[model samples]
Every structure is written in C-alpha cells, then in structure tokens.
Target: MTIQLKQEIDKVYEEDYLLWLEQTAEQLRQKDIENLDWEHLIDEIEDLGKAQKNAVETYLRQLLKHLLLYQYWTQEKDYCADGWAEEIDNFRNELEILLRSKTLYNYSASILEATYQKARRSAFKKTKLDIFPSECPYTLEQVLDLDYLPE
Candidate 1:
C-alpha cells in the first residue's frame, strides 16, 4: 500500500521534483550561497506535514549536497580547492549531525503513516462493499479480502 501511495505521490509532484533539482544545481553553479537562506528553508520545511514533509526533507538533503559542493568550490583561494575538500566532508558530517539531533523528520513519518493507514482503511472498506454486492449499505465482512493493497 505504501508503494502505491508513493507512486501516486510521485506522479502528482513529478514536475516539482525535476524543477527542484534543476534549481538547486543552478544555485550551485552560480555560487549563490547568500541566496541559500536556511531560515526560510526551515520555515518552508516546517509548513509541510506528514509524508510531504518527509519528501521535502529528502529533497532538501539533495540541495544541501549541492550547497556543500558549491561551498567547496567557492572556498578555493587560488582555485587549487585543496582544504575545501576536507571542509566539504566536515560540512556533510555536520548536516548529518543536525538531522539527527534536530529531529528534522521525527514527526513526519508517524503522521504520514497514520494518515496513510486511515486512507487505506477507508479505501479498503469501500472496495470490500463493491466486491460483495451487498444490498445493505453497511454490511461489512468479518474478515476483509484485503483487495485494496497499496501497490
């Protein structure tokens, strides 16, 4: 069921994903570190709830990768770009630390799971009624056939 939901969600936002990657990559090439506002980013992330929030966080991680790469490129004094390699490594480690310590996606998984479960149950109930062809509107089976699997 999760697989089907993931597929549907991907289908719904396919364009957004592509655009986000392109923009992030462009920001990297332009060395637009000043425009990579983390506070606004965090606010945008916070506005999302459940699976959408998780998805956004995953996207943000990709953006962070590009940002770190850009940081490395910009930190080069003579284009030698030596010390920045280590700095990039440290930056990635720091991101990991922040993600772990800050509970960035802590609420997202549970909220999404609960919402998904509710929707799945509602869908399954509707399908079961359709399959049985019962005259009574609310005659649910003791054991559902489980036809409305996620994927």
Candidate 2:
C-alpha cells in the first residue's frame, strides 16, 4: 500500500470505525492484499483476545461473589438468599454461554485465582466477614455446576 492509503486507512479507523470495518471486510473478501490495513487488523485481533479474556474473568468473578454470599455471610441470608441464588444462576448461565468460546474456556485457569480473590474481597467488604478461607472455596467445575450450591 502507498503511504497515503495506509494513512487514510488508519485515519478511518480512528474517525469512523464502521467504515474501517466495512473496508477491511471488503478488502479481505476481494483479497486486496496491497490495500489491507495490516497493523490495525493485527491490533484489532489481539484486542479481541484480550476482550474475551476479560469477559470470562468478569463472569468468573461475579459467579464467585454470589457464591460467597450464598455459601457464607450467614447473617443476611434470610433477606438476600433468594436474590443471591438468582444471581448465582444468572452468572453460571452466562459463564456457560461464554465458555462456548474455546479461547475463554482455555484461558479460565489463568484468571481463576485472581477472580476468586477479587470476589472474596468484594464479599468481605459487604459482609464484614473474616472467616472466608484463604483459598477459593469452590473449584471451577463446582462454580459452573448448575446444581451446586454451598451449604
């Protein structure tokens, strides 16, 4: 690609992302290698991976938070149990759907400990409970189990 074309492509990416997307798609479909925005395309693809990783981690963290509330924090159980249960269900369902992306599923392990720690801290903040185990209480499978609930 000429310097001018490359600059234009980069400009479109910043000024009008939709146009950049359409142009990129057309370029790929037409196999116009000369005009393709290689750098931006590479960056976008890498960003997609990061986005998927972050999304999976977010789901895991949320799942852990609700599970912690449901399993421990006994004082507010009467008032919050049903709501917490519903949230646990929602987060699990979301994780199941997200896990269909193989990248997210494979990357789950890398984020598990951090996600659990964040969940523990969040639950601790709300309940002022200091009794939570130093480690995660549930395994990844247990958290994702549709039928599992802490007792």
Candidate 3:
C-alpha cells in the first residue's frame, strides 16, 4: 500500500487510535515507508516517551511529598501518619518499576530536584508548618529505601 492508503485513514487517529496504531505498525513491519503517516507516528512515539517520564515524575513527587510530611510535620502526626508512610512505600515501588528502563532511570534522576521542590511546596501547604528544609532532605536512594524514615 502507498502512503495514500495511510492518509485515507487519517481520521482514525482521532476516532480509533488502536486501529491507527496497528496500521502504523503494519506499515513499519512491511517496509511500506511510502504509506507511513510520518508526522502522527513520530508524534505518538514522542508522546509515549513523554507519558512514561511524566508517570515517573508524578510518583517521585508523591513519594517525596509524603516522606517530607511524615518526617517534618511533627505537630500533626496521628492516625494518618502510618497512611503517609504507606503512600511513600507505594510510590517507591511504582517508581522502582518505572525506573527499570535506562532512559526512564536517567529521566527520573534528572528531575529529582524539580519533583522534590514541587513536592516540598505541596507538603508545606498541607502541613502548614514551615519547619522543613529549603532543599530536599532525602536522597533518591534514601527516598526509595523501604527501611529509611527520617529521625
């Protein structure tokens, strides 16, 4: 098939993304470059990478927020404290899986400070206690550690 055939189903990207994806892959596998939807295919591939990186940053941000709250919000500790710890654990586990890919690993590591900064601001807002440090207190390794808790 020619790229003309791919263009015939151009609307499929918005109407039936799965079919568009399948057709795109078929074009690649069959070496039908002439029929390939170059622009949308490149966009989808780039978006997929961005989505993965966003997930990593989101989980890392949550983990950092909960850890900061658990450690620094000294006055508000109560029945919910354990829940915060559990969230930290959950985020760490999710990140562990997401970070297994080398690209994602580096992506996550690179954004640690930005994620921590965002989380820290949110943590401060949640706790309303200005006692936390100006910078991230936990290292990425420490944040991911199941055993580590701030003293």
Candidate 4:
C-alpha cells in the first residue's frame, strides 16, 4: 500500500508483463486487496470480456457467410459447397464453446442482427451475386442447430 510498493508493481507491469500477471494472480488469490494493481487489472478484465464477445461475433458472421454461399450460390455450389459446410461446422463448434456462458449467449443474441448485416455484405462481396436476401434468412435457433443446413 505504500507509494514505493505501488511504484514497484507499476514498474513490473510495464517492464515484465508476464511476471506482473503472476504477481497479480497471487495477490488476488490471497485477497491482498491493498497490493492489487487496480487500474491495470480492471483494464485486463474488461478486455477479456470484450475479447469473448468479439470472438462470438466473428464466428457468427463467418457461419452466416458460409451458409449463404452454400445455400444460394448455386453456380459454385458443386465445387465449393463441401468446404463451405466444413467451415460452417467449425465456426458453429467455436460458437458453441463460447455460447456456453449464458452472458455470452445473450451477448451473441443481442448482436445477431448487426452481425448478420455484416455477414450479408461479406457474402455479397465474395460472390458478387445479387441473390442474397436483404434480411437475414436464418433464425438464431436455426443458425445454432448443428443438424440444420438450408435446402
């Protein structure tokens, strides 16, 4: 709690980040609240939450893109459908892991519409096709269903 101790922790945070993380964990585990690096710890925690939400958004966008391509890009479907399906499965699996947290699941649902718009644009850009719908075609339930694929 002394000025010198705070300065030492700050120096470690700047010069040796891994060491600072270890020290921070130890301090937290021991409930040494006085010695905690409050500012940096708060920043790191916020960043972690953002990272999780960002990851879910990314995966959902990718899944939607591939789904669009696979279902509607008939010209290339024969050649690329299998690869697209595989990518969809991969993204879905990644999403499943992240969405296990109820907070993150809700976060994903909250962003679904905006994320769909982004994915729609990406699909159009990639295929240079005008067939994709202006609104999202898949519901969250359908999108998350492992057994579901558009006919």
> Over the stretch 26-103, how does candidate 2's per-residue lDDT look in tens digits?
999999988888899999999988887788888899889989899887888899999999999998898898899776
Kindly list the per-residue Cα lDDT of model 3 for residues 39-135, writing each as its tens digit: 8988988999999999999999899998888887777667668888889889988988988898998887789898888998888888787777888
Please report, in order, the local distance difference test score of every candidate based on alpha carbons: 0.39, 0.88, 0.85, 0.92
* Estimated TM-score for each candidate: 0.20, 0.95, 0.90, 0.95
lDDT winner between 3 and 4, please give it: 4
Candidate 4 minimal-lDDT segment of 10 residues: 127-136
The CA lDDT at 54 in model 2 is 82
Off by over 4 Å in 4: none
Weakest lDDT window of 10 consecutive positions for candidate 2: 101-110
lDDT of 1 at 5: 50
Q: What TM-score would candidate 3 get against the native?
A: 0.90
**What residue pairs are clashing in model 1?**
1-150
- For model 3, the stretches where C-alpha displacement exceeds 4 angstroms are 1-7
Screening candidate 2 with a backbone cut-off below 3 angstroms (N, C-alpha, C), the clashing residue pairs are: none
Candidate 3 Cα deviation (angstroms), residue 93: 1.0
The full ranking of all candidates by lDDT, starting with the best, is: 4, 2, 3, 1
In order of TM-score, best first, we have 4, 2, 3, 1
